[model samples]
Target: MIALLSALLQGCALPSLEGRSESHALKRAETADTALGRALMPQAQARPGLSGILPLADARDAFAARVLLVRAAERTLDVQYYIWREDITGNLLLDALSEAAERGVRVRLLLDDNGVSMDAKLLALDRHPAIEVRLFNPFSVRRPKALGYLTHFSRANRRMHNKALIADGQAAIMGGRNVGDEYFGATDGVLFADLDVLATGAVLPELSADFDRYWASASAYPIDRIVAPEGTAPAPVPHAEDDPRAARYLQALRESRFVADLLAGGHLPQWARVDMVSDDPRKGLGLAEKEDLLTHQLQQVLARPPVASLDLVSPYFVPTAAGVDVFSRLAARGVRVRILTNALEATDVSAVHSGYARYRKDLLRAGVELHEMRRGAQPQGGGAGVFGSSGSSLHAKTFAIDGQRVFVGSMNFDPRSAHLNTELGFIIDSPVLAQAVTQAFDRDIPASAYEVKLDEGGGLVWTERRDGQTLRHKREPGSTLVRSVWIGLLSVLPIEWLL
Candidate 1:
């Protein structure tokens, strides 16, 4: 019964691990040394500015940054994104890129093949002479059924989820924001309240190198390959050498919401700055090493016993027993350690919530402040609401420590993110950025989350706030009748990797 229930819980799983063929191996081999290697090497330095971490709170800010970089480009513009839609946000940026390309700026655009849906305008932009667009891990699910199935197996395992942009071989944007509305707070229903750093100075070279490695990678397919069937006209290569108006791309970007945020917030010249230069990108570093780095950072932060507080605001919280122990040690030291994650009813991925629910009692017993975001957590600061509002979910992944250090990025506190997915983040030393993000976390705590509390009768209950009303509900969903049914029915599935 337990096996059957586990299997049922793994329903409709996406393929997470797939064996690689020689062809795939050869492709990776081709780009590994050439592309990944170049991104790690140092390059000529650019003149310094007020180089520090600039917080991007809206889509307009992100868009504006891209435009500024593209306009400022003299030699090259290397961009790598997980998804670049042809939506309003995507088109505006593409227009900017096209303009830059016409001005003789070498623009190499690389994207993950997973999320890009076919659009005529995007295909046409890719056909531009100056712009060289490539898709990482190319697959053709948009085609006929035959092609989709064949391509399906090809994309079953690896996924390119990195998002970065570099311009003039000088400056770069690296963080969680992808080239999409939701990521940038421009989407209608679900704007992701995300974080990214507009890093200048030494970090630019490292960022550029990262872009280059992916650009020359074996998985990269030229934009021309992002085509349609015989009936569809080949996307026109607009703005050839004869077209001299690509210069306007910069101006268009300047007028966008992206730039307005910078100009309005003074994020450019204002804000404390940090100049970081990494001689190597993590490609040379193994996954286990990255985990160790995170462990080290956490240990460093928790080294001194604190009487006050610890708060975690990760959207996905799936800590292993070892991770739980770390928090327990902190609690033992009298630190008020608290954690926030999505509730099962409000979670977008139920399997992840299932994995997390397994640890609720352990976490609570260790005196960790555990919170689960309730549905309909309203969007703050023009950020989008999670879908199913009235039952919206939590999507932000962040962690704040000692009201001082903060880490933000695409990384989810999950086994997949910690081990499988390649994640990147910054250790913001700025108290200001830390406070801003922490405050954001606190604001939502009241209306959108439930505090995990133990009753005097040794029962677990979740006290939540909604619609200006506080309500206490059973944390274990009261009856385990459904759980028992599920355990008996869902345990025999072969979907662990997808989860």
Candidate 2:
């Protein structure tokens, strides 16, 4: 019966990409006269071969940067992401894109099919002459989208996990953020402690070029090709002033100095040799060579083993046996390897936690340090620091090696990232940014996360510090017994590769 259903679904396959017109990113020279380009030119000239980097740790500032860039664009905007929610922030950004299109700016939006649903609003956006929307590896059967996975499991499993926003070919924002209320801290639900960087100069061209590759890849299907036209675009969501939850974000935007500082050349972006590493877009079709994968590129970039310390942060940390072995060897060599991931209660995906939980003992036995972010732990800087809000989950994927090198982007330390998804990030040769991460590990992380250790009897224990006192828990802190039992059951399954 399943085979028959799969065959029936396969018969109604995806639309052809035969005559899809090709497009490329606007060249720096083509956009040099635009406002953003003109404003950024002097800084680029001063830096020459180096890229300027401004870390966007604050959620509001991050959202503000993208919207402000869209408003500032005069020539083009190339946006890509794994997920784009239709929440307040999402609608606001989409409205900003439409406004840009109205000003004659060409906007290209590329989203992963599995991450979004095709609705009338998206179809309406695609109808705009200046806006083009494409989906990466889309589903043929829009309704019951999960059926696509059942019919074409091998193809549907691989995904495009890259996230980027480029404006006028002069500046770009790339990192781990997706467009959503949770990502921007507008929701009272589980917020994601994420990170992103605003980059210009030498990195912008490369980043734009990478977008073109994915934009033109075989897996990219125009929205019109996948979903038929529906109702007209709905009226834009009311302004932030109308929504109580979003009003705070409006105040944040007004208070943010990133865009203003950047335009006036006062942002003081750290100039460094930054390299963008990404999996080939062909990876979505399972056709990319092993050497073209982001994993291989990252390995090449961080070839030298850390002599002092390694501070790694990932929300879904399912380090398989091989990763555990690597960390164990590093610890054995006197390297202080520390890792931070979401605790059971803090994690949104419990199944992924199971994959990580099964390997906890091996990691502790090998002297590798582990920290789990506590639910409702307020980070420093009013929830704008490396960690997030009073109630949040760790979603940032980043690490610093020896306080000299730093990596930030969408790739997580898990089998899914390494093998299944096409990811993107940057390897920055900047001690300033790297040390900031390491310093957070030393200070903020301890206050916001629980330290996992082995007790006298070789049993696991979670240590927490609160109210100037130390507290200990024998089991996973803040997790229920039933949840722990379920995790134990899931941990025994041989599904680590799918994590």
Candidate 3:
């Protein structure tokens, strides 16, 4: 039995990338005559060097934009994400991609192996001549995937956290969202308050080039190479017309004017100088140079410190000792650094909250303001707005600096984003968008989040304003004592780097 087990494990070894075909994204000229290109070119040409940016803060609109982009693709569709759940919206998007392929649109789907598990469905999708599926940093052992971690911890630990969708090298959507029900507000469970932008013009090519880099990287293995051949792909999941959630999303699709306005040339975006920043694909193998990392690039781009205000919204805000010092110095210099992150009961990952919790007092003492999003904090008007819907947890990773610039993307203000996973985002020189974030901090944030402050005794206190009354909690609100104790225990551990 032991010998057989050893042989089975040995057989699970990964295949080599020798002779893998190299493919590049279609050039701008090749897609200039495409439908999406035709609709967006005039505005793009007018701007010359600026990219048209339409922030998809509404969850429904964010999902609609991707679907509409896929439906409009003429030449090719390049899609990449860390997670693609097999739920309602995920299946719908998969079906849409397959439909696009049926119409002769070449579909290249790259997903992180750790975030997906539908081997049979993915292998089936790979069978389509028009569609190709690849997994990033895939596990060798199919069953009991933990075995791969034991065998190749170094490689398996690093992930491709970038999310993007490019159509015919003309238009793209990039941001903090993955393809899942939670991301799109299609679930009654924990909905993620995420952000994505529909971008056109100068940034499309750069985003496409970045997708190509990741798709062709050594870590990306074709699905056939990872999973064995399965029978014909299962029939695509049909739209659940009967499910109330599905009906609601369908209504949202009909209500969303984002794509329609773009196609009709009626929607004008804030044309600005948008710079794309991404971690080198080599970072997945721990081979990227320090200068090539996204952190260094971000610092170089936003070189000057914030002169006025810094409003940051990160779901997992683990500002290690270094980050605390930076924020402390910023506050000392009179920068109004206000951060909004998930509270303990609201966070999807409790471990991450521990990492952020340990530094709460230090940050408050430095004059930096802290706001913890309350669990189930629905957006005003009961819609799935940028801050999220009912049963929502903050998943957006964004920040506005000095009220003159803003950043929207997948990079989080955490150690893992700094040194572990590859990340992507864009920095835009748009006061309009930047102030929108700051305005939210001034208005909606105070209503939905708890204010963390240092009391007279130097201990932390959480103040909640609800239904015209101000409430105070000595302990973390909505979080149980045992859970808090567990988090405290985790805070003392040496796992901040992993958070």
Maximum-lDDT candidate:
2
| C-alpha positional error of residue 493 in candidate 2 after TM-score superposition, expressed in Å | 1.0
lDDT of 2 by residue, 1-499 (tens): 9898768776659888999978899899889999888888788988888898999887777898898889999999999999998777887888899899999999999999888863667777887899999999998888888888877888899999999999999988999999998888777786888899989899888999999999999999998898875546552334434666566677767877866876676767899999889999999989999999999998898889899999999999999889999999999999999999999889999999999998999999999999999987776554456543444788889999999989999999999999899999999999999998998888888888899999999899999977778899997776788988898899998888889
TM-score of 3: 0.95
Residue-level lDDT tens digits of model 3 in 58-95: 77778988989999998999999999998778877888
> What is the C-alpha local distance difference test score of each model?
0.57, 0.87, 0.87
Q: Clashes in each model (backbone N, CA, C under 3 Å)? A: 30, 1, 0
Shift in Å, residue 348, candidate 3: 0.9
Q: Which stretches in model 1 have alpha-carbon errors above 4 Å?
A: 1-50, 67-75, 119-123, 140-155, 185-187, 223-233, 236-261, 268-309, 379-392, 457-459, 466-468, 475-497
Off by over 4 Å in 3: 1-9, 231-248, 255-262, 380-391
- Which stretch of 10 consecutive residues in model 3 shows the poorest summed lDDT? 233-242
How good is model 1 by TM-score? 0.70
lDDT of 1: 0.57
Ranking by TM-score: 2, 3, 1
> Which clashing pairs does model 3 show?
none
